[model samples]
Target: MKVGLKLNEQFTVSKHNIVQVTTFENEFHLALTNSEYLVISKDDKDNSYYYTHEFNGCLIEVPVNEYHRIQRELTEYFGVEIQDVSSDETKDQEQPEPTA
Candidate 1:
């Protein structure tokens, strides 16, 4: 996930601009001007599709294959790790207590 990025670099993720790289879903989400979201779709063929979504956009499509890579890039660029929700935590929260 470490891509050797510096925090002071212009490419660094900031409050106004963020490079949302979704690794598990292999997609890139760019938050553009207000009400605009740019999504980059990655496929097995290495084909990259660009999409623009407005505030009223109905649906968002994120390619599954490029998710992992996207996440890695985001982490590298932001110098942070994406916290994953553990299955054990989910089970613990969902299961009811047994009677003593």
Candidate 2:
């Protein structure tokens, strides 16, 4: 489910660095550090999800579908490579049909 976020919400990034999320009419404001990182977490209830730093608190909770979309966006924005663990599991689960 999509978690609605309000303007002027502060999310911790580092011990001394915090990012403020704001939306002004048709514009959105978000500040990321030079060494920023993105981490997504899926809530146990209702498959709710959020994106945040590995060492920080939840920045925003998005819909389950948005989680992967946001992850891809972050990967491209940050120019980093993220391994897909789920894909590997799916590959391993595929088995050849037994001859009858």
Candidate 3:
């Protein structure tokens, strides 16, 4: 399928309700809002790298190299900071504090 057609399908089913699509650094970036975006690109070798972002709930399929390239571009362009959260952090927050 053509890249445009693939992007259309992604927009139709995206949970974030993609409102715009643009190209940056030769990759497609689908925007749901100013703070939320999804990047898509075609893999040069396998053409089957697919994954979903847990936070934004966006689906993406692209070449491994393109994935990293676009990720960096998105971060830089949007000034987004990607943080790693441990499961322990969530567990600690879920527990009630001890009463005095």
Candidate 4:
């Protein structure tokens, strides 16, 4: 899939395992296995615009258009839907701490 991503951009795909955009470095440097590597994008700028996935130690960036395209392809290929968090919802859902 062709998705946009960026360098140093962070995304939380799950509890563990994150896809980072790196041009000069590999996952090995970060103590990660290459097998866990997913897909890289065509444009590095687009790679910066990701969901919750954090691209740590990324040397390259992916464009947003390309990234979205790849996301669409992956969603169809795996038949899984991807949901993004909305800032508006976050603000409205914030709760205050209880006091004694």
Candidate 5:
């Protein structure tokens, strides 16, 4: 399963499958497939959230100013990686496995 994401102007738009989620202290670690991971943390002072995604040893911080929107999305997507058609090509693509 995978989850498609298009966060505003952020160019990190793509589908990701989360293999594991670990919380340590105030930050959370989300290990995704394809050599990627995300570390998310919340700022209680302003009730905002911040995160950084790493791929191939490179990490980029994603700035999200909308607290509620992001929070809602995170809650909705967390533990919710599902197959999604993020693009037209994927919509028409065939499944990898053939069912009986």
Candidate 6:
């Protein structure tokens, strides 16, 4: 299954290419079969994320905020459920409480 992912750029990745998708609270990671790691930040206000790939000793950053979208697409594409490993505490309020 070709999963359509829209990040900093458009991408069509095979379901097989992605070994698994795991999340720890806001952090999301994708383990690829090619030993490449894709990380997505929990930032939505910036509409971006910190994505890097060791491309010949160079780390290219890809700003992406479509984490949920990508997750949904991948689940739908592969017909699999996410094995959430986060606890209730980890799902706490995202915004920090302002202090005077």
The best candidate by lDDT is: 6
- Per-residue lDDT tens digits for candidate 1, residues 1-100, read 4433222213333434553433223334556446454444444434323333423322234344344544555556667874333467676888999998
Tens-digit lDDT string for candidate 2 (1-100): 2232222134333312324323322122344455443333332233222332433432443444554554454445445643344455566677666799
Per-residue lDDT of 1-100 in model 3, one digit per residue for the tens?
Answer: 1112233323433333546656543346677755577656555544234343444535466665645654554444445632223367676888999999
Best candidate according to TM-score: 6
RMSD of 1: 9.1
* Model 3, C-alpha of 84: deviation from truth (Å): 32
| Clashes found in each candidate (C-alpha, N, C closer than 3 A) | 7, 0, 0, 35, 1, 1
- Estimate, for each residue in 13-50, the C-alpha lDDT of model 4 and write its tens digit: 33123333222211111122443554444453343443
Q: Which 10 residues in a row give candidate 1 its minimum summed lDDT? A: 4-13
The per-model lDDT (C-alpha) reads 0.44, 0.38, 0.50, 0.39, 0.46, 0.56
Give the TM-score of each candidate. 0.34, 0.34, 0.30, 0.32, 0.37, 0.54
TM-score preference between candidates 3 and 4, better one: 4
Show the lowest summed lDDT stretch of 10 residues, model 2: 20-29
What's model 2's lDDT at 13?
Answer: 35
Q: Relative to the unseen true structure, what is the Cα RMSD of model 4? A: 12.0
Name every residue pair that clashes in candidate 5. Answer: 2-82
Give the lowest summed-lDDT range of ten residues in model 6.
Answer: 54-63
TM-score of 1: 0.34
Winner on TM-score between 3 and 6 is 6
The TM-score between candidate 2 and the true structure equals 0.34
